[model samples]
Target: MALSPQDLHRIAQSRGWRDGRVEVFDTASGKVTVKGLRATRHAARYHLLNGVARLLGLPFLQAAPMPGGRQAQQTEVARLRALHGVGARVPEVLHVDEDHFVMRWLGQDHLGDVIQSHHPQAAALWREAGDALVRLHAAGQYLSQGFARNMIVDGAPAAPAWPG
Candidate 1:
């Protein structure tokens, strides 16, 4: 059916980013992403479970919930997590669960809009974006997939990363 923040918190072990019906709280706040398989029942859960396990300092799937199912994906997610902060420009990993994560919500703007927009500041934004990319690479982390449809605008900054 659908996944909820509470569900994710139940089985999640760390923090991360999400793809299915997610809500970006502010400049840096992710709740469900920190939770994993229990976080939701969507395609991303499979990858999230794999990619963010190590990012959130949680054990890989083999050492976690399902044991040996999809070890390869798990490895990749671990890579992403290990590279969580290569430079000082990486998104702050908020938390991670079985297959979910939460992170600092970078401004909810996509590359295309940032580049193709008619805004006068688009040019400057483009330059900043270049720097952002370098900084991200320096963080030593690599996202297997994240573009366009990956972002969501949730207005100005809000509450803490997650309620305790």
Candidate 2:
């Protein structure tokens, strides 16, 4: 479902940021999630630092915090659309403005949490996760935030596995 800029703003006002970054808003219409500029800008800084490192003949620098809101959201939307076009599982982008964009709510524990918990199905889960990444890369773009924390698994229980 698409939300207008006003809708996004209204929702943001309703639900404060999570971890001081993401905001999740569930409405009678549908659920919308908003992510701030941290990760996107971090990737930007990574590239900037990477260029400097290359000029100095040094190893690549790690991603650092980037600063910008709307631009970051634009970049993110483009990236998401690209990934979606290539068959990657991603949230549906609803609307975008300068500071943030509204996207269909994708609710689930982060893949990282599940992995850390040693889910009995961890092997299969990891395999599927790796395959998704491979597919995304095969689409000819590297997702800067390709960490397990960024991946969501739908319909999975919020529990850990017992050791066999």
Candidate 3:
């Protein structure tokens, strides 16, 4: 069944999310992350950042802030599809509405958590993340935010199969 923004908000509230824009919940199909694009609290921060970048003559450093509402929802849906089409490890979009969309939950842990926890495979994971970024760039696709906190790390590390 398709989920609407109201349904998602109800679920999020039940899960202890007061006013978050994103919420992760489980369904019969599987776990999913629902994002509501109706908040613009960070718009001013992006505007300031972009203004600074423009003044510095660094157009490439400027990014479009989340437009909020329907436009933001559509843009996010399109970007997710485009990125997934080019073999990027983005979440698969499951459902979309006028102001909200649901995607398959990739994982709960971010790359930043792995680094902070000093995971044994942190270095290898970091290298893999770099390789993924290079691959994405080679495909002519870029992320608005590519920080470690935004990169989700799924599953446990596998032992190398190389023969010594």
Q: How many residue pairs clash (N, CA or C atoms closer than 3 angstroms) in each of the candidate models, in the order given?
A: 29, 1, 0
Give the alpha carbon lDDT tens digit for every residue of 1-164 in model 1.
23445644442422333344234442212332232333222454566766777677765442333333235335535654566535433355555434444555456555555444444554565566556656666756454444433433223222232122
TM-score of 2: 0.75
Q: On TM-score, who's better, 1 or 3? A: 3
Q: What is the C-alpha lDDT of each candidate?
A: 0.44, 0.71, 0.76
lDDT tens per residue, model 2, 1-164: 55656666586565355356678777555887777555434465577787888888876454444445666666679988876677677887876655566678888688887778887777788889899788767777678778889888777776743453
- How many residue pairs clash in model 3? 0
Off by over 4 Å in 2: 4-9, 37-56, 62-67, 160-164
Q: Cα lDDT for residue 44, model 3?
A: 80
Q: Return the candidate ranking by TM-score, descending.
A: 2, 3, 1
lDDT of 3 by residue, 1-164 (tens): 45556656555455333257788787766788877667544578888999999999998999766676677778778999999888788998878755567898888778987777777878898999999898899989988688889999888443242122
Which 10 consecutive positions of candidate 3 have the poorest summed lDDT?
155-164
After superposing candidate 1, which stretches have Cα over 4 Å from the reference? 1-21, 25-84, 134-164
As for TM-score, the candidate ahead, 1 or 2, is: 2
Candidate 3, residue 96: how far the Cα is off, in Å: 0.5
Give candidate 2's whole-model lDDT.
0.71
